[model samples]
Target: MLIREWMATDVLTVDENTSMMKALHLMKENKIRRLPVMSHGKLVGIISDRDLKEASPSKATTLDVHELYYLLAEIKIKEIMTKNPITIQPDETIERAAVVMLENKVSGLPVVNGKSELVGIVTQSDIFRAFVNITGIYRGGVQFAFSLDDRPGSIKEVADTVREHGGRIVSILSSTDMAVEGTRNVYIRIRNLPQEDLENLEKTLRQKFRVIYMVKDILKTV
Candidate 1:
């Protein structure tokens, strides 16, 4: 999916002149960790809770709570905001945004338009949601993990076995172990089938393939 499809709209931003104390207060009230900084209708920088903490007086200092608040109020977001922060375009695929965040060890990205204007934000949570949806992690289905010969039609046999037992395959994935004597691990998800039929299917699969694991469950959790 595209970044625009999952990115959060109505992102909150702070101006350079905004006080660090004000920014922290806004974040706390909204339960957000970061805020993009905007100036003259342009993206100027990005600030986060960590920035607020860093700008505060050190715990070793003898400043009282009121003194610390005053000191923080004097420090502007511009002083701590990351200038020219890295950004991704809204049209970029979710995978690209995820890769960028992972490579930079960052938790979120400011999504921009073709003109480099911030339109939304894609965070780690968005990426995870995309992954789960794409993998059918929320849809009720059966799951089986087993080893099979790394040869043609080996997967077909397993699939055929499930089909013979009136099971409908929803998705299947395989990982090959080239270092382990030409073996591959396969995982399959199927629509719910009767208990007796599922057992029979497992028994039949074990007759032809190495059955390492078998499980069934409702994919979604309330």
Candidate 2:
């Protein structure tokens, strides 16, 4: 999947000249965490509610509510926003976007086009949803993860092994590490398998491959 497919397009933004008070109000009214600051039709910075709280006058100061309000009104979005934030292109793969977010330790990323125009925003929740969809992890299917040779028939052998044990394969994925010799990590989703037969299958697999790891999930009758 791509970032554009899962991004939230209906974004709220504020002009650079907008007062900090107004920006905070907009965020509160919209129930959004961050606001993209724009200036002359270009993204200049980003502001979050945390920034507003941090910039507010502390109790140590003798300013009254009215004075605090006036002080906030005098400040601009550009003054407290994070400038030149890391951005992802709309066409970027979801995996790449997730990698960027993880490496940067950010909860969200502005999705921009080739011209650097913000089209939407991608959040960590979007990545998690995409991953769950792609992996079929929530379907109550038996999951198996183990190492296999990269040769063509290796996958067929794994499938056949599952079939021999009456396991219905749902999905399979090879690991991302391609340079690690002839071995590849494989994840397989299957139907239920009995404990004794599952152990037999594992013993058989261990006789063939290295049997790095194995797991069985029994279907619960509700």
Candidate 3:
């Protein structure tokens, strides 16, 4: 999946000179964590709720409530915002976005176009949405996992066996992360089947391949 297909287009932004008080209120009213900072219709910086909290006075401060409010209104977002923050492009893959976020220890990224304009934002929630969509978890109730040889025809052979057993494939994913050398871990999702047929299929697969596990009601909690 691509960032353009997953990022939220309708995102809230704040001006560079906007007061911290106004930014706080915007976050509260919209129930969002971050806001892109703009200057002359150009992307300049970004700020998060943590920045506001760090800029705020301590609870033990002797200053009165009115004074605290005034202080917040005087501090400009540009003063506390992250200038020239990390950004991703719309054409980038979701996997690339995830890597950027992970390496930077950030929960979200500002999506920019070729002209360096903020087009949207991608967050952890969007990443989760992409993962669930790719797994087909909501529609496919059962999943079969295996450690198969790292060869071209391995996946197709498994898929062909599934079809022979009246199984309709929903999604197929493979990874080499935890597999032994010369092998890859494969996961396949399929629609629910009758209990008897499902049992027979599992037994047959176990005999044919290195079956890791066959799970039913895979998305019961979700």
Candidate 4:
């Protein structure tokens, strides 16, 4: 999936000179953790809730409530915001966004266009949505995991068996990470199989392949 499909286009922004108090209010009102700082219609910086909190005066300060509020209003976002923050293009893949987030240790990214204009924002939640959509787990299905040979047609062989047993393949994910030499871990999710048919399929698969585990997942709550 692409970032544009999952990113939040109606993004809220603040100017560099905006007061910290106002930025905090915006975040609280919108239930957002970060805000892009804009200048002349271009993204100049990014500020997160953590920045605001750290800049805020401690509760044990001797200042009065009114005085503390005045201090916050005086501190500009530019003073605390991260300048020239990392960004990603809207057409980029969601997987790429996730990789960027993981590498940079950030939870969100500003989405910009080729012209360097902020068009949207992508967050960790959006990446998770893309992942879950691909897994087809929300729709309720059975998943079978196996250690298959790292060779061509190995996946097709398992898929063909499931098909023969009236199982509709939904998603097939494979990885070589932590697998034995010359082998891969394959996870196949399927739907539309009766309990008896599923059991029969498992028996047949175990007889022919190395069956690691099978899980019948029926979601009770989403």
Predict model 1's lDDT versus the native.
Answer: 0.86
Candidates in order, TM-scores: namely: 0.83, 0.79, 0.96, 0.96
Over the stretch 1-222, how does candidate 1's per-residue lDDT look in tens digits?
899999999999999999998999999999998899999989999998887887778879998888888888898999999898889998889999989988998898898898988899999999999877765645636788878888999899889888888988877878875325788988888877778888888888888889888877663574
lDDT of 2 by residue, 97-129 (tens): 999989987878888888989899898899999
Report residue 60 deviation for candidate 2 (angstroms): 4.3
Whole-model lDDT per candidate: 0.86, 0.82, 0.95, 0.94
The Cα RMSD of model 4 versus the native structure comes to 1.2
Once superposed on the true structure, which residue ranges of model 4 sit more than 4 Å away at CA?
none
Let me know the TM-score candidate 2 reaches against the reference structure: 0.79
Candidate 4, overall lDDT?
Answer: 0.94
Candidate 1 pairs with clashing backbones: none
Could you tell me how far off, in angstroms, the CA of residue 200 lies in candidate 1 after the best superposition? 1.9
Best by lDDT: 3
Q: Is 3 or 4 the stronger prediction by lDDT?
A: 3
- Candidate 1 vs candidate 4: the TM-score winner is 4
Please give, for residues 14-121, the per-residue lDDT of candidate 4 as tens digits. 999999999999999999999999999999999999999999999899999899999999999999999999999999999999999999999999999999999999
Lowest lDDT 10-residue stretch of candidate 1: 132-141
Decide which is better by lDDT, 1 or 4.
4
Please report how far candidate 1 places residue 151 from its true position, in Å.
6.8
